[model samples]
Target: MVRTADEASVFPDVVVASIQMAPKVGSKAANLKRSIELIEEAAGHGAVIAVLPELANTGYVFSSRREAFELAEAVPDGESASAWIDVARRCKIHVVAGIAERVEDRLYNAAIVAGPKGYIGTYRKLHLWGDEHLFFESGDLGLPVFHTEIGRLGAVICYDGWFPEVYRLLAMRGADIVCMPTNWVPMPGQAGEHMAMANTLAMANAHSNGLNIICADRIGTERGQPFIGQSLIVGAQGWPIAGPASKDREEILYASINLKETRRARHLNAFNDVLRDRRDDIYDPMLGTGWPLPRH
Candidate 1:
């Protein structure tokens, strides 16, 4: 319920709810039901924005494209997304949920943002991880931010969070907040390591770009692979306002984001200004002709 200066705001703070739930593999109806329950709970709590983990509607780690496609659904026509849209409109909030999208005949790891106005925007997973390349098509849609009642929201699916350039581009496009719906697997003893990486990504990117970064990661073990749920909310200063918790239970992390802080941080550190300091003219060789080095 965070409101800007121009609007008469009821809620002065921006509340974001990040959901961590286990998705039933290939069961669209069950997944949709769980998503709806979480969305309703978040909305009831007066959250202006709610984010679910990547592939929330379908468990990740599919063995074949057919399996992935079987779980995929059309954009707005998809029952899961459509139901969330109704909830968003009814609750008057913004929702960002991940789904396996069936685009014509191709399948994609997609994230859809819905509000009272219906599906506002969609971002397909730009960076596939491990065996993902074998089952889904990489998204070509460029990084773009969507203007919503909450604020300028940008999204990057699970694997895409590993990249820095994406955050830079989103920041350049005037994103107040960036959402990452991730499915990070926790190695036997590497939970701390994974959380550190996620924290670094959130803090470094937000502090440098002067944008709020929220990540909703899946919890619990799926197919015997443990997922460490560390859903968090980081301010523009790269500090965790919410969490970096373990994966034993489901919890809602809330933070009141002040857009004014972004401007203040940028004024003080101004790391984004570094982008303007770049000399593209001198780096032309980096974008060299399409040729591989000679394999002598």
Candidate 2:
């Protein structure tokens, strides 16, 4: 594991929190206020890092394009990002929350990372899901990892979780922790409150990539669409350290993570390295040129 002199000497137990709250449709003000409350609550509990659900400040289920358009704001200059930056600076914690991003004429499904120092970076969701395609422009920024005082932080939003490449890219970039801001709806044919596919995906992604993943999801139905509220803070071992929180209640989940151990855990054994053992040479021959047209 490659570590900077500063990072190597500063290993400490860090607490991560995931906030699961219900966001009202078209109520941007109420959603931002509620998000601030949850953030304050998490910070008070000694969480050094906190995650919030997708479109946390604007809410999901926009009645129309104009509704989404009206609610979207500019990136670090936006009110929502600026507010979160203020709270993060005041609480001395890192905040990762999803918001609607408006850049000139385009709107995007985006998440921003703010810390005690102020706004750090932004990640727009690379993959669009369902109605989101109608509202958001596909993310142009590739996977980026922000180096921080605590550890390296990487972020993903909602549908981006479905792509293994997202996690692999982040892990390869040496990210110690990944914060996911999601708005998961129930998948058809996947019934009951068993483990949600979102949780399963999070677990599998964490295990395969050998990085800790913290996920925050919303609860309650908006515009006849029900959200699967199972906020989680996964350890480096790919298991839940905190919660899959309740499916219907608004809650905050917290867990302590040791990032140094996570860096060591990526080595499966003396004989195998998860990233080093890839048969990419063979696979690349087929994939390097992009899909070679569908097999006849």
**Predicted structure with the largest lDDT when compared to the true one:** 2
- Off-target runs (Cα >4 Å) in candidate 1 are 1-12, 187-194, 269-296
Candidate 1, position 187, lDDT: 42
Off by over 4 Å in 2: 1-9, 285-296
Q: Where is model 1 poorest over a 10-residue stretch in terms of lDDT? A: 287-296
TM-score of each: 0.86, 0.92
